[model samples]
Target: MKPQLANRVHTLTPSTTLAITAKAKDLKEQGIDVIGLGAGEPDYNTPQNILDAALKSMNEGKTKYTPAGGLPALKKAVIDKLQRDQELSYEPSEILVGIGAKHVLYTFFQVFLNELDEVIIPIPYWVSYPEQVKLAGGVPVYIEGTAKQQYKITAQQIKSAITDKTRAIILNSPSNPSGMIYSETELQEIALVCKEANIWIISDEIYEKLIYGDAQHVSIAQVSDDAKERTIIINGVSKSHSMTGWRIGYAAGNKQIIKAMTDLASHSTSNPATTSQYAAIEAYTGTQDAVEEMRAAFESRLEIIFPKVTAIPGFKVLKPQGAFYLLPDVSEAARMTGYVSVDAFVEAILTEANVAVIPGSGFGAPSTIRLSYATSLDLLEAAVARIDSFVRSKWQEDLL
Candidate 1:
């Protein structure tokens, strides 16, 4: 046979974060003083408490395969966290562990979706949602949420996107690119729509602990009893414990769905790294101090970033109620400059301004780009200054 790729492989687009990270790496290797805002990683080191626990596990020879679903202790820890943090209840059998929340989400589709089934994703979502759906032979139907909506979608938009074949909906609070946190009222309304339609809510709460302000993250499961049964809660230690590379994540839901996911994961990853599982156990069971400290720092940066970025003539920023990211409507900047897309603007800024932010196109929104403030306050202040200067200098008043 001539050169060929599987249909699934052919349809897969390389991960946007990986692509951006690779480009940044290459530039850095070549000695470019690149400031990378493209990565989705947390800057904080994995908590020492968690790290110490993993090292102890290794010393105790906990490096072998555990259960396909996960180790009992870790699963129980996750369950405990849900109960303690969000006031949600789940049994061990209802929880399924995988390599990370992304894996949990990907395997969710792989286990549940069939050819031509649809996944409803709010646009400007995490970059992986559409692709993961596609890999599972599902179509991703994106519904755009504009800056006017604070980059948050309404129940009506979700309802309009549904079809009889729509198998699931992905909801991310403290969303990656926009950093927009859904209010309890908004989630309750969306939960009602999805519950009536029997749509699966794959709630991504990986950033649950990263949220700022008095706004709370109401897991659809926490909305009410009916909503709880219809939800698969996606969570991990990556953001909460700054353990991104430790590669442990899990989800909880109705046991039938959890069983299917475990079956799929059994043959695929088998189990997450045993050491990572031990580390994650500590993450859930350990102190809340590290997480609180990080949130405070992010809140501090948000205050600094909002005023400075918005001061730029074409930039429109909605003070994000949560998450460490800010997605300013830079569509106006594109018009005033010669750049036709956020991708082009990102490239220009990196080349001329030496600052890197992910293009909105990657997050399924072309009018906005994601600027992460997950770094030091000084760097965030400096990056925004450079971005402000670059956009202002290129302002030609729609000349392009």
Candidate 2:
């Protein structure tokens, strides 16, 4: 008989974005022309200075294990970054650095949750949020954020979702998938709700540095001292520095919780790679010119391709305020093209048009599809044009 896997593994859904990206890669291996719009990482190489920093650390023999939480210098760099960017103060004891923002968040859920405890997740969430909660033996309670609200949940919705089992709520501004940022006023209101309920707030701020136009990134912890006590700010250098492969992310919050996460990390993974931590320190402390340059490139691509995405026969997209993705509701396009579901439409696009986009079903927004503009302008433009042409041709065939 086959060995039984843990129940936890069964509940976890494989990341649809990764799956689609792998499929696109397989086709490319076969020498097919494929434009993949499914990437979540920036296409740019790591900045030269950060690369040099990593090499220097290794050459200087800083290649051993750091403290399970992080190196003191790296933690100081993170503290300085928080103070400089958000005016939030933190100490080394209150910070826990893990492999990446994703892994840091996983460690957090593992430390924070108890079996059957509830975590209130907003709809259109990052795919890993609910899964991580489940892995930590927490129940996921979802609240929907409509298109009219720009995919952001209101404070009242959060209050209504709270129950006796409620342990925490996740707030992702400059959010993944939708890229909608919560305003300072909105965060203050939500902070009030969490404070009243006495539950934790997991503020995912990995994309905080990528804001464009009039949008601003605000940490829930910045609302007030009480809010700061109740909020854990999750952030890292991956998105900001184009250092996704370096795998350095961190959390800052109540010292007790941070300690608990750090303890867990010590057993599961001894430390974040020492070299990556050095790279991250440089990421935070170095000149930020490359960071801004990458942001400008993404904003430029968004401006150029967003209109083309909207021009598709039945696609409805909200212009993203930050981050690199566009979550467009393509249900009408799917229906007009004779597909019963958006997932099927995404598959058809990959198979027929050789364009890979993620189905939003993985994000709890099944009617939509996610397109990442993290690649070059030529590729993004070509991908959108292919999608538009595919939809138009299918719609015309249906009419005939």
Candidate 3:
């Protein structure tokens, strides 16, 4: 007889974004002209200076393992960055680096959560948040953020969701899936709630440098000292520097938590890649012109694509303030085309229109679909046209 798998492993859902991207690649490899908008990484190449730094590190035999938490220089760099960018101060002892932001988050949940601890997560969150909580033996309590509010939940909603079991709340600004940023006032209110409840706040600021238009990114930890004491900041060079494959991300907060995470990392990943650490050092302390250049590119793409996407019949989208995704409500389109569900509509688009987008059901927003604008402008335009044509054709068929 076959051995039974662990319940935790059995119940885990594979990442929907990766699954769809893989399917799109399969179709492309089979000679189909598939345009995939499922990936979350920037399309831009890693900056040349960052690349040169990694090469230099390797040539100098810096490939040997460093501290499990991170190199002293990298941790110091992270500390300097937090101070400079967010106006927040941190000691090196309060920093912990991991394979990536995702790993840092996972390690955090493992170190902090007890069995049945509840983590309040806003809906339309990154696909991994709830699953990561579950993997840590924690229960996820979801609060829905209405479209009218730009998909940001109110502090009152957070207060209502709190219970004795509530351990932490995950806040993602310039959020994944929706690309909605929380205003300073909204964050101050939420921070007040967290401070009163003494709930830990896990602020994922991976897209901090990608704000567009007049929108500004604020760190929850910067709201007040109490909030800073209770909040852990997670960030990386992945989105800002186009270094997704570099596998370097860091966490900053209470030294006790950082120490625990470092101890955990000591047993697990050992350290982020040595060369990647060197590359990240340059990414942080080197020139930042490339960061703004990429942000402008994304903003330019958004300007061109947002209108085109909304013009499609039965689709509605809010202009994103940051990040590279657009969550468009497609329930009307699904119903108009005689489809029963958004997932079916998404699959049909992949199969018929040859355009890949992640279904919103996976992100707890079933009436919508998430499209990444992290591809070239030409490809985005073509994908939008294909989706427009596909929906129009289905609408016409329904008329018959």
Candidate 4:
């Protein structure tokens, strides 16, 4: 008999961004000058101090396993970070350090959800949220946030979607594909709905440090004591410190939830790497100069590239207030270029224009495409130019 795979994974849709990136990589190996803007990470090297700290920990023989939740010293650093940045106080018992924010969130769902539970996930969500919930035997309920709404779901929308089966809502401000941050007023409204519904709030703040311009990041947990009591904050040093490979992310929340997540981790990953945990402690306790420098670079790129992107024939973009991605509605452009779907338009842009971009269908916004500004300004400019030329040429051909 043939080996059978689990039904949960069989229905899972693979990440479109990674698939596009892999196709771009294949083109690059063939010596095609394909410029990829699908990366969901910073292009900068890890800060020198963080690298040095990791090495220092190894030299000191701190390689042994620590507590499944985290090193006590690292937890202290995380606690201090929360107090300093968010003005929130937390004991070590309320913190759980895991491999990354992604893993931490996965562990959270595994421990918190039961079969047939419902999780309210805002549409155009990060690719993993729905998949993780399904793996935990939970159903994903989506609320659409149109481009006119800056891709943000409303509190009334949340209230309307609630059912007795609702277990939690996954909120990612400074959202992944859209790059939009919710205002403090908006967060308060959402908090009220969650409180009334008595559902948990899973606040993913991994991109907190990468905010740009006059935009501010206010965690929903900061809305009120009741909000904080029910919210679990998922954050990490990956985006903030260019430490993606180091794999250190932590969750701060109710002690009981933290304990359950930590217990699950003990049986699974055991704990995050000790060296990475030491590096994370340094990330929280050390200077944030590099974080600011990277934010500045991304902001500068956004200012330059946004105008160019909007100039592409039939492309419409909402100026992103935070994060490093630009989600542009290209439905009109696709039609003008004689393509039936944005996904097809995206493919033509890669193969013909030699520029890789993520189709928005994977993010539940089929008319749009996501481009990362997390590359060199030179490459960004060149890639935009290619797309502009390609779109115009196809548009002209269609008119003929």
The digit string of per-residue lDDT tens for model 2 on 263-357 reads 99999999999999999999999999999999999998888888999899899999999999999999999998999899899989998999999
Clashes in model 3: which pairs? none
Q: lDDT of each prediction vs. the true structure?
A: 0.86, 0.93, 0.94, 0.93
The TM-scores of all predictions, comma-separated, are 0.96, 0.98, 0.98, 0.98
Clashes of each: 0, 0, 0, 0
Off by over 4 Å in 3: 396-400
How far out, in Å, is residue 112 in model 2? 0.7
Candidate 1 local Cα displacement, residue 147, angstroms: 1.5
Model 3 scores a TM of 0.98
Q: Let me know the TM-score candidate 2 reaches against the reference structure.
A: 0.98
Q: Write down the worst ten-residue block by lDDT for model 4.
A: 391-400
lDDT of 4 by residue, 1-400 (tens): 9988988887688877777888889999999999999888899998889889989999999999899999999999999999998999999999999999999999999999999999999988898999999999999999999988899999999999999999999999889989999999999999999999999999999998888888999999999999999999999999989989989999999999999999999999988999999999889999889999999999999999999999998899999988899999999999989889999999999999999999999998999999999999999999999999998888844343
